[model samples]
Structures are given as structure tokens and as C-alpha cells.
Target: MKSLQLLLGLSRGQHGVSQSLAIDGVWGATSSNALASFRQGMGIAEQGLLAPADVTLDALRAGLPDGVPAALLWAVMINGSAARIEAFHQPLLAALERYGIDTPLRIAHFLAQVAHESGCLRYTEEIANGQAYEGRKDLGNLQPGDGVRFKGRGLIQLTGRANYRAYGQHCQRDFEADDPAQVSHEPALAVDVAGWFWWRNGLNEWADQDDLRQVTRRINGGYNGLDDRAFYLARARWLLRG
Candidate 1:
């Protein structure tokens, strides 16, 4: 772990690339400060941690998989093999780190819910035509065709114009003006949008307490796919918690 931190120019003081300051892998105050700097530079929260998969060890721009190899996100399933990690990986991990989805349980639940919503990232847009949501005032579908225009997209599937608008406001992106399609097209935004939802709703609290039921209820609006979600959560725990 120190080797990795060193390789990324984050060893104590100048020890990483300078023999003059070389102190092996002794992570003192200097090391923690450097680590915090790296996290901030990566657009992650300025928290000093070393979880090997969250904000702490995730900024491996020097080429350590953005998240761990297994946590790069299951992008697609071809012949039962999920790929797309190679093509679309960094954003998911970076967003997880940036949005305070920092703990093992938090990361596990976050990925599990997104995996289920996106079919393990195989599909970005919802399969339905969204006709059923037409003129649904509750979703801010006040305008004609708003349902089809603002259908579910992104990692956790940001649905409706109101949600898009709200998320855009939080991120200062003007999503509704630019169009919700941007969320589907941009993997980083898609991932960040989901992170935004998760953090804003404080779902991390549920994850930390091991309340998968509440997490599911908040994300899915009820126990729509409890078994599948549980399955994914268990899979996440196997790779991470184990």
C-alpha cells in the first residue's frame, strides 16, 4: 500500500521520487498531507483515508485501476462476461469517492443499487417508453412529452424533469436546458448523478447501519427487486468486505 502511495508521489515528504527524502514507507504527518492533496486534485473529498478502493486509494491516475479491478463497475455482459470496465471505469470510482460514498458498506450498497438499476451498467436508459408517466404532475412532467423527454437515465436512472433540473442545479450543469440525454451519453455525469442522489438522500447512513431494507426503499421507492438487490449487495460484499 505504501508502495502504491509512493508511486503516486504521495510518500512522506519528497520520499516518493527523491532519494534525498527517502524514508521507506513511513507514513507520517507529511504523508497524510500529501494524500489529502492528491484526493483534492482528483476532485474527491478532502478526507485522509486509505481504503484501497474509495477516495483514499482511488486516484490512481498513474494507472492503478480507478477503483480496484473488481470494482471498476460491471459495464456489460457478453456471453455472460461483464466488460466495459476498460472503456468506462474512472468516473464511477471517482464519483464514489467524491460524493462521500467512502466506506466498504457504503460503496457496496451504492454499487449494488446502481448495478440493479442499470442492469450492471449494460443499459443506461430505461427500457420503457415512459408513456405511463405522461402528464404526471408529481414528477414535474407539466409540459407535453416531458415523460419521454425526461425519462430515467444515468447510473441510478435520474427520472423526470424535476429530478434532472434539481441535479443540474446542484452540480451547476443546467441539465434540463442542455437535455437529459447528456446524462446517458456522459458516463462520468451518469455516475456522478447517481452519487448525487445517494449522498443527498443520506443513504450512506442506512448502509453504515447495515439497513439494506431502508437503502432499497429509498433508492427503489419500495422493495421492487429486493432479492436481486440483495444478491448484488452480497456479491459486492464478497469482493470488498471479504
Candidate 2:
């Protein structure tokens, strides 16, 4: 419950938290309803009861979309020190702001993606090299769907060889798909790559559509058939409203 509260950024005394969760079908007064809602939110089976291995802190910290990456999650799991993960994220927040993605929804979603991708900095080794530069730099692949290397990188997980070629054109860098080292090694390049993907992909357009789920699916792929999409949308709605 405490972790959920933090994930939702809700205060303990806040009544609207329940309302918000209930309204979005994330939580319910009835156990069955609550379980169904959570499952629906996560695009999983709604068992109507919290499973022993449910999201809890570990799962939430490492699942995809909003969950943290496996590496950083492991660190937290072993050390029980989430502070290290938090510390690595400070710069990422600034990077998002610097790239012109200022909305709270965009920021939160961006953070969520980053948390899932970079292991919240738990995988610094990935950054130091280009192996994980899939979406880290502004350099793109040859073109959309180009079968090259070092594709989508950074927070967006930009993949495919063509993506890297295109990113290179946008950033005016002669990027090589085989050389992810260049992309991941430099944080500036990584953030720029992510920003460029966000701008180039239908993300900006969907964001303008004012449909949170639509935008999230557009950015993260329509995985889970947009089941967890509602949560992303709900968060976006709140952030946009603010």
C-alpha cells in the first residue's frame, strides 16, 4: 500500500487517491474489483486477489513500460538501496527538461521508460559502451525499417538498423550501427537520440491528440493491447491537468 501510494505520488491522508484509483479502475473497495482493476491496468489476468508474487516492490521496479530494468532492479534487490538508482536518475530528469518534453505526463512517462530501460542507471556499463545505444544518441539508422545496426537507443529503446541511419541524418552525425559505443558512451548523444525519437515518432502527434493511452501505445508499442495503457493515460491525464 505504501509503495502504491509512492508510485501514485499520493499522500497518506489523500482521499482523492482512492477516488482516482477507483475512477481509473486501478483500485476498488471490493477485493475482487480491486484485483480485476489492477489486472486490467497491467493487462494481466485479474485474479481478484493480490498474488504473492504480484508487482509488489520488486516487480514494479523491473517490469517493462513503467517498471525498472532487470539490472538496476537487481541492485536494489540485493542492496536494498534504491537511493543509488534515484541518484542516477537526477540527470535524466534534467535531460528530459532540456529536450523540450516539459509536460508532467511526458516527463513521468519518460522517466518510466527510462526506469525500465537504463535500469535507472543500474547499467552504467551499458551507457559507457554503445552496445546499449539502441536509442541513446541522435544518430539514426539508414531509414525507417532499415536493416542496419545500432538502431533505436537511449530511453526509447529505438531499434532496427534503419532507425540509426535516420537519427544520424537528424543529428548530422555519421553513426555506424556496429558502433553503439559512440551513442551510449555520451549522455548528451543518448538524450538527444531519445528526444529525436519522441519528436519524430508519432509520439508528439499522439500527445497532441490528447489521448493518453493512444500516445503511450504509440511510443511503447501497443503491447498488452493497451491494458496497462490506461495507467499511462491516467497518469498523463493528471499531469496534463496540472
Instruction: Give the best candidate by lDDT.
Output: 1
Model 2 whole-model lDDT (C-alpha atoms): 0.47
| Candidate 1 lDDT tens digits, 1-242 | 34433344422233232222222456676656666655555666746556646644434533333334532233111111225454446787788788888876788788788777877677778889888788988889999999999998887888888988899898889866776798888878888889999988999899999788999999888999999888888756544542
Q: Worst lDDT window (10 residues) for model 1?
A: 72-81
**RMSD score of candidate 1 (Å):** 12.2
- Residue 200, model 1: lDDT of 89
Off by over 4 Å in 1: 1-67, 70-82
Q: For this target, which candidate reaches the highest TM-score against the unseen true structure?
A: 1
lDDT of 2 by residue, 1-242 (tens): 32242333321122122323321224435433333444455556435344557653333333323323322232222222355444444445455565666664565455444444455444423333334444433444334333234534565565655565677787787665347546666666666666777667646455545555665566666654354445444443332332
Task: Give lDDT: candidate 2, residue 129.
Answer: 30
TM-score for all predictions?
0.68, 0.46
The true-versus-predicted C-alpha distance at residue 207 of model 2, in Å, is 2.9
